[model samples]
Structure formats: C-alpha cells, structure tokens
Target: MPHATIVEEFPKTALSRRTGDVLAAAATGPVCLTDHGKPRFVLMTMAQFERLSGRTDGRTEDWTRDLSPEEQALFLAEIDERMCDI
Candidate 1:
C-alpha cells in the first residue's frame, strides 16, 4: 500500500492511555505518534507494513466498508473527540 498521506496523529502518551482508540484508527490507516509534538512512530496493520516493506504483493482490502452502523458511530465519535481536543 502507498504510504497513507492522511495519517491519524496523536501524542505518544495516547498510545498507552488510549491504545484502543489508537488501534481503531490504525485499522483504517497509519497512526502517527508524536513525542514532544514531533512525529515519532507509525502504527499500522501487519498487512500494510508487509505491503509497504515489499514483503507482500500490494493487494489491499477495505475493511471499513464492512463496519456496522454502531461501529461507524463509535468511530465518528472518536474523530469528533479528537477534533475537540484540537
């Protein structure tokens, strides 16, 4: 997969305090962790990592297309919360 241009970003502290949300966001694309407000780490699915690292063919799937209504709502809510934090 091509590197996701629109990656989700959060403070490094969030990785421990909000691991679930970080992971949920990562499921869609890369999650960028910032330490002292500088980009530090990128979290992505193993498949994505493999594809980007040339360990696998570039075929990809859109798992988000299968999200249930409730799951979609939760994801949106998390986005809203992140927006509020901004």
Candidate 2:
C-alpha cells in the first residue's frame, strides 16, 4: 500500500488572505491549497522544488576531466582500491 501524504490544507480564500502564513508553512513542507474542498495546488519551498526536480547550479563537470593523465590514473587506482575494500 502507498503511504498517505500528510499535507496542510488551506482554502483559496484563506490562503489569499494569509499569504505570509501560508508561505511560512510551505517553507517547512508542501501545503495543499484547496478549492471547493478538493486539492488544487501545492506550495513548497524553493529548496524542496530543486531537490524534487533534480535542479542544480549547472556546475556538474567531472573534476577528473581536467586532471593530467598521471593524476587520472592515480585517482582511478585509489578509487579501485577503495571499492575493493568495500
């Protein structure tokens, strides 16, 4: 069975009136905004969105790519030794 998600629900009107409070709640976790007693939207922190969407700073280059051939060989040898230990 899938686990149920516990969300904080707020009516659209209430969310509009208490925007600050709603945003504060979203900072902790997702908040379900409801319209007519049904979920209409989800509010979450920017960090949460980034995490869920696999968003990064666009600096995902491999450090080994810039290394000298000798350095690369040494690094690979160290990694192989470490993996063997595990």
Candidate 3:
C-alpha cells in the first residue's frame, strides 16, 4: 500500500499575501488551496508533479518481460474479474 502524506491547507486569500511561504511549503510537499472551506486546488513542486504523473527519461522497456508467471496470472485474473464486473 502507498503511504499518504499530510498536506498543508491554505485559504485562497493566502495566495496573495503568503505566496512566497506557500511556494516554500510546496517545495517540501503538496499544499491544498481552499475556497469557502472546501478544497479547490493543490499546489506542488514541478519535481513532485512529474514524479506523481509518471514522467520519465526517454526510455522504454517491455514491462511484460519483468513479470513472473505467477504475477502475470494474478494480473490476468484481475483483468478477468474487472471484465466480469463490466
């Protein structure tokens, strides 16, 4: 399971007054910007964005080659389960 990181929340108004602080905090992790006490947007560093979005260097490999037979069977089983749900 993936671990969840705690995000700092700031009101939209803080954007103008604390832009520098907000950016500094985002450098460490995600910062949530809220409007009317509800989350409206998230601010994060470009490196964090790229990491979360799966941006990688220009290299590709056949993913299947890395999977063990049992792992492949489990993957296919998951696909079959989802197909049945559909």
Candidate 4:
C-alpha cells in the first residue's frame, strides 16, 4: 500500500498500554517507537516487509547476485543479525 512519509512516534511504554493504537498507526505507515526519549525501533505491516525484502512470490529476488562473494556474505550476515531482533 502507498503511504505518506509521516511516521507516528510513541514511547516504548505505549506498546504496553496503547497497543491497539500503535498497531493502527503502523497500518498506515512506519511507526517510530522511542526508548528513553530517543528513537529506537520502527514498526510496519507485513506487506511492507515483503515489499521491502523484494519477495513477490514465495522466493525473493536475486538482487545480490551482482555482489562479490565476500560482499554477499557480509550482507547476508547483517540480514541475519537484524532478523534475530524479530
């Protein structure tokens, strides 16, 4: 879905109290979750994730094929690290 650049921000505690509201905001665009008054996390819908990850069908696009072996390994490692956070 197309969305505006505007991102709704909320403190981390809001996730515990206003969970529904936070999710509702995320449906429209990315939601910024702050920790200790500092921007920390972003929440987005699954469709946005699939689109950003370049997964149209069951498989993902081979955009990394052009990268060198070492570069691809480094990129894959970074992707693994980020996925662990989920």
- Give me the displacement of residue 53 in model 3, in angstroms: 0.6
| Candidate 4 segments exceeding 4 Å error | 1-6, 57-86
Candidate 1 CA-lDDT value? 0.68
TM-score on alpha carbons, each prediction: 0.62, 0.55, 0.58, 0.57
Worst 10 residues of 3 by lDDT: 56-65
Residue 80 displacement in candidate 2 (angstroms): 40
Per-residue C-alpha lDDT of model 2 across residues 1-86, encoded as one tens digit per residue: 21224357888787769997786566555688889999898876544455456673423226467877556545544544475589
lDDT of 1 by residue, 3-49 (tens): 55436999989978999989777766678999999998998766556
Better of 2 and 3 by lDDT: 3
lDDT for 71 in candidate 4 is: 59
What local distance difference test score does each model get?
A: 0.68, 0.61, 0.63, 0.67
**Which prediction has the highest lDDT against the true structure?**
1
- The Cα RMSD in angstroms, rounded to one decimal, for candidate 1 relative to the true structure is 9.5
Considering every candidate listed, which one attains the maximal TM-score?
A: 1
Instruction: Estimate candidate 4's RMSD in Å.
Output: 12.1
Candidate 1 TM-score, true structure as reference: 0.62
Q: Candidate 4: lDDT of 63?
A: 53
- Candidate 2 wrongly placed segments (more than 4 Å): 1-6, 57-86
Candidate 4's TM-score:
0.57
Q: After superposition, how far is residue 72 of candidate 3 from its true place, in Å?
A: 36
lDDT of 1 at 36: 97
Q: How accurate is candidate 4 locally (lDDT)?
A: 0.67
Model 4, position 6, has a per-residue lDDT of 39
Worst 10 residues of 2 by lDDT: 55-64
